[model samples]
Target chain A: MDFNPIWLTLKLACITTLLLLVIGLPVAWWLSKGRSFFKIIIEAIVTMPLVLPPSVLGFYLLLAFSPQHGAGKWLQQTFNIQFVFSFQGLVLASVIYSMPFMLGPIKSALQQLPVSLSQASYSLGKSRWQTFIRVLLPNIKPSLLTAAVLTFAHTLGEFGVVLMIGGNIPNVTRVASIAVYDAVEQMDYHAANVYSFILFAITFVLVTGVFIFNKYQLKSPLE
Target chain B: MISINIEKKIKTYQGQRILKVSGEFKSESITKIHGPSGAGKSTFLKVIAGFIQPEQGNITVNNNAWLDTVSKISLSPQKRMAGFVFQDYALFPNMTVKEHLEYATADNEWIKHLLEIGKLETLTTHKPQYLSGGQQQRLAILRALATKPQVLLMDEPFSALDPENKLALITELKLIFQELKTTVFIVSHNPQELDGIAADGAILSELYINN
Candidate 1:
């Protein structure tokens, strides 16, 4: 019911959105150009998260980051970071859980671009990396923006993964979705409605924004 | 300035048809490729420009081997140093004339001069979709020239333009090439586009040479 949960959700969305954009750009580019067998395998893995149950993802993440587990123990010993039951842990989990949302549109955009573009840049004597940075990235701006927006909104509304891995620890793991879940469990109708309305409004606006931008982009040739 | 000795094949679903062509393009010349569409005229242009690959061929430019099937060498496109003007324009449809001009380069006083000379100065902000057919073709010309390539490959570059604009562009391009001292290869089904532009000297029937 409180506004604090809403604020927390926004913060999480903003952070995840930025992280996905920073990481997803080059990743999507590689996926676009790669011919390796591992490419499809990795794509399948990324999209698996999209189709997988949120709770199952949370379970695996928790296993990977628990101090008693092999990966978690190694990370804790080397970097002194525990991914389970922490806000940072939640962010990592969310990023992993949402990888497909960012990668798909980006891959599609890169695919739609003609190979002649990079070739054209090359014919001008620019190197491969230069052509990618200068020519290719500029062309895929709309897709990049779309990836960011979808990832942000998707992360904001994430629930099962946050609850399972984050353990609903207030201030540290108590995301707004979890708060709404907690309100419903206690049968507090007013409080539940408040959190629910905020989440609904945020997602509604985000989707509407995507459509608006998409329409404008279609009218323009840039997208 | 550029030379290509290559044998390529266009592999359709049925079978591959070999395209064997070799030639040199010296600076200060306009080379015209004249052939029927199925003769792989455009395909050869793409091979020299590094957009297409030959099954078993060698492509060398300015004493460099870009592709040597016998030697198992395939260089990336960026290293090829070519300028290509597609029959389709291939302009970044979203970009403006200014951006396209900038795409060609900003340092050359000659580029700036060409902008004014071609009368493209006023259309710098216009996108290709908004441009007239002739204007879009000029945009392609502007882009190719900016690359400062040793050789330029054009695929029917003027096929869509009106006579006046096409003639004006050819004039501007010729002047720019003269000043830059560069080599160009233009693809034109029209004898008129090839007639005046291929001023260097005849190398073969329907082909010309500069040196």
Candidate 2:
């Protein structure tokens, strides 16, 4: 009956989802606008987490952030932050884990915009950044919503990355997925069911909302 | 005063070539760049607007380097003040007409005057996606005109309208420019050529666009 792990998972999912949105939007915007070579490379990198088994990405992240790497030593020295098996480590894992979920919709929405819209803004003497903020961002409202929600739900379902990075230390690192595995290992079906049901509900609602929105709300402004 | 000089511009896409115009466009006149489909008409416009770079050439507007292959002086569209009206009426779908008009700081006493001139006083809040072809055409014209650019560029602006509406839009555009005295550049394939021929107030800068 370790409820701490379940609570920790929810907290991690929310925080990781927020960070992913912040990080993913810029990546998506760059990918959407840049030349094919850069766009292709970044897009490939973002989907790498989804392509490989989660355990692979998790193991790689652990190596990247371990004391053996200069980055790991610098982080520790500068901020006293250790990410080998911490909540921050889980967030890093989740950002890679759910990048595609956030980036795909944003890229699609950006592509749907008319080239003239940006041209019109620019021709009126607005900078590229200003045009992006005032003209481009407002037009892709549906994509932004889609990216945020999908990333949130996708991070909730993350297991292998958290398992590798978080190390299942209850209240500190252990999360719902890890808790469910623990319950199953202990033959405690009831505890596992609680975490599993909530996870399922969250994903179901998130995806269903996307379908409804796409069906009724996204009648593309560029006709 | 606006002036554009282009030298030996060439562009090729997937082994297909279009647009080979070598001439100068002066200000205070509506120079219609006429040509058939795949004529590189739009491509030429884009090259001057800073959206596309010519394979080998230099373009200067008012002695300012808009594009130069020699010293590589290429300016962005925002810096050029070359207004464009897209063929498909490229309006911002997210914004209402009022927002679009206000966004560009094109709001002035002159706009109220052009509103009367262009006859666009009523459709102030509508978006292009919601408007009909003719309505969108009119809106595109107004949007470009709103900026009061030294050189206003249009790609097949009146293609979407019937004869009467096209004539009406063209006549109104001529009258407005007669008052404003701004330079204009337009592209027309055929059928649309008839309207360009009728802009009597605008001095012709360069000739030979296809029908």
Candidate 3:
């Protein structure tokens, strides 16, 4: 019956999706350009989360941000910020776990756009940045929406990474997925069902919205 | 004057081919570039517009070095400021006919003039998808001219227009080009497409590229 986990999950998903959108756009744009070995390697690394087990990523993150050694130690000492078992840790993990969802659609859409669009913009004395913001991004609005919704839904469903890095702190790190696990462990089936159904309903709505919006966009004259 | 001597390697269905073009185009003149399919006619326009970088080349526009591979001084496409009307139109699906011209220039009078010249003033609020093929083609040309560029590169610009429309548009364009003093490089498969414009005493130099 406690709603703290649901609120925390929503907060985490919102923050993670926002951060990834800001970071993913430029990265996706860079990766969409013509291929090179260096770009291929970077793309592979960004795409690793989709295929790699969430627990594996969580385990590495745990080690790296343990505050006892390595990056965690430096971060804690220099910035007085702790990433392990904290809300910040959950946000960071969700961003990493759901990156492919945010980037895949965007990168493919950008690549699919006719190259002449940018060239036409450039010939008008528009700078590369201007062309990207004014021309390229406007044409890919549907893809952008799809990417954001998918990332949010994926982050909402994240259980393994959240459990591994963000232990079960009440309001700080206990998102809905982890809360469901905790409820089941304590033999509270009713609480577990409530959390499970809510997560399922939200994700279903988000994914269905994306499909409906995309279909309408296809019929609309203005892309 | 614009002098270009460039060699670019391009990929065709047959395989790799080198496109070498050397020409000196007079200012305020119209040059018709005719070539066979896959002969790099479009590629040559892109190179001049600075969208494609040739392996070795030098392009000097009015005695200013736009490109010099030896000195590694190649201006970016923004610096070139050459207006281009893509073969496919390349109109922004999100923009209306008026918005396309407005994006290229801030002068309202110039935009109004371009719309009238293209005969697209009545369809200014329509997007590319709403416009017919010929209308879209005219919009592309109008958008390019909105910038009032010193040079304009057009590829198969009149392929969609009917004979009457083509003739009317060409007649208006001839006067506009002279008024603006814009050097034009038009690529067309049909040799007689712009004959009327060429016959009107504009310097109608011809360049051919064969594979």
Best by TM-score: 3
Top-DockQ candidate index: 3
- Please, what is the whole-model Cα lDDT of each candidate in the order they appear? 0.78, 0.76, 0.93
DockQ (C-alpha based) per candidate is 0.48, 0.58, 0.76
Which 10 consecutive residues of model 2 chain B have the lowest summed lDDT?
Answer: B3-12
Better of 2 and 3 by lDDT: 3
**Docking category of candidate 1:** acceptable
Per-residue lDDT tens digits for candidate 1, residues B95-179, read 7877776765767675677677667888878887788877777778778878676777888888877777777777767777777
Clashing pairs in 2: B34-B209, B34-B210, B35-B210
Residue pairs in collision within model 1: A122-B78, B98-B124
Off by over 4 Å in 2: A1-3, A34-39, A68-70, A219-223, B1-18, B106-108, B191-201, B209-211
True contacts kept of 2: 0.75
DockQ of 1: 0.48
lDDT of 3 by residue, A1-223 (tens): 8999999999999999999999999999999999999999999999999999999999999999999999999999999989899999999899999999999999999999999999999989998899999999999999999999999999999999988999999989999999999999999999999999999999999999999999999885645
Better of 2 and 3 by DockQ: 3
TM-score of chain A of 3: 0.98
Off by over 4 Å in 1: A220-223, B24-27, B71-75, B199-211
Best candidate according to lDDT: 3
